[model samples]
Target chain A: MIVSQKPIEIVNILTHSNRIKTFYLKLKDRIRVAPGQFMMVWIPDAEEIPISISYFNGSTMGLTIAAVGETTRQIHKLKIHDSLYVRGPYGNGFKIPRGINKIWIIGGGYGIAPLLLLAKKASSMNVKVISFLGARNKDELLFYDQFKLLGEVFASTDDGSEGFHGDVTTLVEKYLSVSKTDLMYACGPEDMIVKLIKLACNHNLNLQASLERLIKCGIGLCGSCCLDPLGLRVCRDGPVFPLKILVKLNELGCYYRSPSGVKVKLSD
Target chain B: MSINVSLGALSLRNPTILASGILGTTASSLIRVYKSGAGAVVSKSISINPNEGYKTPVLIDLGYGYINSMGLPNPGLDEMIVEFKVVKSKKVKLFGSIFASDIDEFKYLASKLTDYVDALELNLSCPTKMGVGLEIGKIPWMVEETTREVYKKSKVPVIVKLPPLVTLIDELTLAAEDGGASAVTLTNTAKAMKIDVFSKKPILQGVYGGLSGKALKPLSLACVFKAYEVLSIPIIGCGGIYSWEDAVEYILAGAKAIQIGSAIVSEGLGIFKKICIGIKKYLEENNIDKINDLVGLAHRR
Candidate 1:
């Protein structure tokens, strides 16, 4: 039997924004998961895409995906009980550092998916948590009430359509100014990751952030998800990495690849 | 129960080897695949200098198979020596794959890797530049000349890898044989593409890329079949092999050994041991004492 490929039935789907939806799947086996871990979702003939675990509970889990690309577009059409091939909980996920009682979680856009899981996990462990969730507008902010159940939420919208008028990073910077934390975590567009990396580095705070790259084989064999020069495979070495590894890559915020493998500056 | 197989000077305890371009970049990765139960592992095709490859969506999947245009990304030969040395120390069965846009580059790269690997697998199966005329590794004379040049400096067995985009698989196989190739790996990823109806354009950033996985299985098998008919040297079957059954099929189709790429990504590192266990069981059931007995068994009338 193929252990990696499991046929899971969709129990339900939670629509957040027009583009983002969370799929709750019922699996035969108990899926042990952690924040920042990603899964490779497969539909028989449509396409295969990598998704981060938005939430996990015993034999069931949720995947928060945006219907932006081809594979994700197909996933948005999936109905309940529809069997899709699911594999993993792959890659190195975020780990709570020792002696860290207070934590800050920051994210923007679809990047909010994994951070939501981190917030829930930290609060369940009785750790104090603060989250800064952002999007293009108030309508795009995700996991509003759920995040509130876990910790304080600072909602930011790029268009000033909600709480904060500027970017999420500004909210995070402002929060850190008012109150400091033992550790910080972030995920978002490359530019945001770059900005957060600098913020964490400057403050001398330990940071772990989940990154998204062109993932072909989530198990690390594909050689598609690489940060060149160091040859780090994002799928295996990380979807989540410590601040040190990101700093080592050197190209962190400066350059990233487009879907076609062309190098593009993060500023672009 | 011994699944050891030989193709010229190279020896593998099991017939399953990691194909080029699949987790073959670093020394740690090669060791990881070796520890996972691969009889041997091949490095991704390295060239004269480092390449950034195509773009972000360099690879994509369509359930049964994948289409990727990695554009042969590497840190070039100079930067790989340290990693190669570390890999050599692990003593994992390793074959190094080298590529070039011209004849001189082929000889130079092969010469540099002489001491780092057990053998050299020359990748002449690219789209353009320095093949017979149009297709690379397709023309018989081009194959012979390229193989001979690399074989000159390569101390170990020199194996030529061919793409399925050729007119005559046998002729190219024979050409490698004539040029003193130790073995030939049949078929690299076949060129393919997918279109996004929503975007009204190609799904891949690059309009065309190579197709692998179950989609290229038949093509690889046919190349091995035809190459076996014409050449006496060992032929390593690659492309789309996912399980032990796929491995056995390649052997039956006259492949001396087989390489697996896309399957490992789908099946995980466990695939190596899974394929090995399945082959041992198949051999035990068939009462076959040696793996070579099954190699090219289907060639009999």
Candidate 2:
């Protein structure tokens, strides 16, 4: 089997901010992928984790990763020429809205990685995209310049270092007061996505939001990433789901399982 | 009303085989599966040593199926065999699925497990590992060598759980048969991966893992259908046999028996009888005398 996995060379690395870095990766061949799709990266014996695509322009892909956990901490230690094993741009991706010329995008923290690509895809399709970007501080804000190239941006940093002086949700509340859009797409913290889902549901607007969960086999076999009560396995049925399906989930930010199968509170 | 069907050298009371990598790691779990109506239960793929496996997120419940990167977590074969011999009743037909890195390890495990279980399923198809599992099963020569070494030493029926990622599924089956394998578990999980866009991180700690569930049905059914066309030996159809119709589809496509893996978790333990009853109902409606007659019926056209 000329398997799905291969050792990819780190061709380039760009520091997006102090905490977040983007790696330019190239495998043996072009890994065709959709904007919201993701890759499973392996660092040999250390640990493997999934990373969403920030940019894929045929030849190479960019992963805007933050040094958040132990695996990502190790990932940040790599230099140019270091090899990283990768398989897939797996899981379902976002569905581009048809005939809609206007879209509103919302994201929090590192969740902006996948939305960056989606913004590019949407804008390139002649859609008027207005992105709402949020982070803890000015230094924490990511892809502001890259996003500026595609569409309009309303940014928020907690310290008021950028566009809006407060929370991203407040920015959305202000925007929704005056105008409405064809679709609202979001990716971010559970609380943020949960809030976005409620916002989208109340407006009766079409929404596609990505969700994250603990997953064992990235494929649909292990039950670790299953959402409670609704029982939706995040790996296959989604990394992305429509508002109608997502709104039905009872566990949408209320709880999640830990790495070893403990039910932990997801209030954060 | 005998539902027995010959799976190469072994004949199961019915065609419902509990696919490996479920709850078969423990003796009680194996007994539970048997009691629930599985014709046979395959153990979790055991190595010579215990594996802690990957951290949390070993399994995810997909609306239709599930994803797992469990890393073959199991107690060592020696320990598992001891528990089976001590606690598990010997009356239930048990198949041991063993994972080893090389030919010698495969041979040794097969030899040790021979008298304890009725059959040995060489787990050559686990998708998550590196040097072994699917890596070993991918090479036709390794498939032959491992099967030959284990077959020479094994007293019971030796079946190879072939990886679906292989270039030619039939080649692996033919090679195993050439190496004296009694049968081939037509396929195992597909190599797949996923990431959490929310965290901008991967879902599984191991990154890459296997894909099973309702999605795998067509691929596995095709494998059994193709293998049946080329082989004299019996085919054990696995991968996504969730319902009775799925099992019967495998039967019509040419599987002597079918193995259920993810469905055990998604549908529940009672799924075994559900499938059996559904199959029985089909047999009655069609006026089929033996369940074996349903096997490979699709080839008649």
Candidate 3:
């Protein structure tokens, strides 16, 4: 329920792609963050935006951001030692299922950031991780080598410049035909996640995914990120949801609210 | 155990209301609040066009309460109507709050929302640099004129939400009543500010924001008490109401209904049901049959 932002100094910055950079901040206090939880990051003189906790070693936290919007673009210009204000490792993060030995990790584009953290956590729990990473091309594939260090890595590029020749879902389908996985985890574009949900449902496999929305106030007070029909606030109720809840969200991949709370049709 | 109260033509199953701008942006949110047991809900103040509002740090938790300057961001009228249609279909008691810089815009907003909402709440007390909120509300003549103009066009009851200006509470309440308002929401947030010492800048993007929480209860209670002595219209007390004790105090001070805002942040949506249970028990213990019997009862002694 705390709304005040505490200043955290950026200790290091790593460029992952032309549009993505991973910034590590030194924490003044210990923040217990699960793999899928996010933080509201504020850049001085710019806007505050929600970013997933891509890496956390108890003392230093990493936020892998895509320079897609004004706030993130401003965040990209900052160097090491510049301070950024942050509040929360908020929302319910991904929960590792008990007694599971093997799991499939699927990520698309910049969505690969959070999955890497989940993979790391799973690896530590003695679970086998099989990751499927996808992007427009090999150049956009985020954390390929990092994800590889955890377990088996399957890469996909839309241009056929990587392991698979088509979208990540097509690669997942091909793998699913010959192999059986106990569970699946994902964080990516809504359309890709929607496709994964269908795949999981058809295969009778359980899937957990981290979602994205136009968030304001990053707390439940403002209803900017509330999902329709269910009235679940993406900020508090979840940024990560399971297949059961994901299927009920009628607005998924079809529409999204603009910053002003206007419901606009999602472009195909 | 009966807690139903009537505010003119409008009847609430209970007296607990969701104050404007807390969680009122979308239809799902309004319906969610209704499902959470709120007697009624007021929307975040909307304008004719989209407002992006202030940037990051628009709100902060001061431990005692909250200070926020959201700058009245909304998706404008047409988009809000789409959300209102869903809320109306579910039969939720919705009060559409609108803010404008002038009479013509207020009239237009009222006409558009009258069909969708149970009532219209004129938001004249949002603390911001925007010329619409306190700038117009601090003027007694403007309050009267704005209320009168909107009331004329509104088919549903009109509730004017005023600021908690200590010396002006009496005049503002009287102006609202004089201008044909069916009810007056005792107060909006008090204007306040906070600064970050290291950064040497205001915490909120808007230099000044409205303060709401436990800290505001006394000021708002005083405003309600003062207004009740002068105006015949029902007073809906808002600000810093977190518990049933706070709700009872407002009733004693002559508020017909109470709006819960900052408390929802700390206590969650369950506060509505909890408050009602407390009030029902208090009434039963006091040998009262209906909550309406407690309205302005403190003034008797």
- Model 3 TM-score relative to the real fold: 0.95
User: Where in model 2 is the C-alpha error above 4 Å?
Assistant: A1-3, B1-52, B55-257, B261-301
Over B201-268, each residue of candidate 2 has an lDDT whose tens digit, in order, gives 66666777788888777888888888888888888999888899999999998888889988764477
lDDT of 1 by residue, A3-23 (tens): 344568899999988898999
Misplaced by over 4 Å in model 1 are A1-113, A117-146, A153-219, A224-233, A236-268, B127-134, B165-167
Choose the strongest candidate by lDDT. 3
- What tens digits encode model 3's per-residue C-alpha lDDT throughout B39-91? 99999898999887777667777789888877888999998998999999999
Candidate with top DockQ is: 3
Report the lDDT tens digits of candidate 1 across residue range B1-301. Answer: 7999998878898888899888777676678788889899998788777765554344556777877766676667875676678888978888988888778888998889998889998888754222232255777898899899888988999999998854588888999999999999998888888775534566555567788889999888988988888888998999888899999999988887889898866687789899889988998999998889898888889
Score every model by TM-score: 0.69, 0.60, 0.95
- Which order, best to worst by DockQ? 3, 1, 2
Q: Give Cα-based local distance difference scores for all models.
A: 0.80, 0.79, 0.88
User: Which scores higher on TM-score, 1 or 3?
Assistant: 3
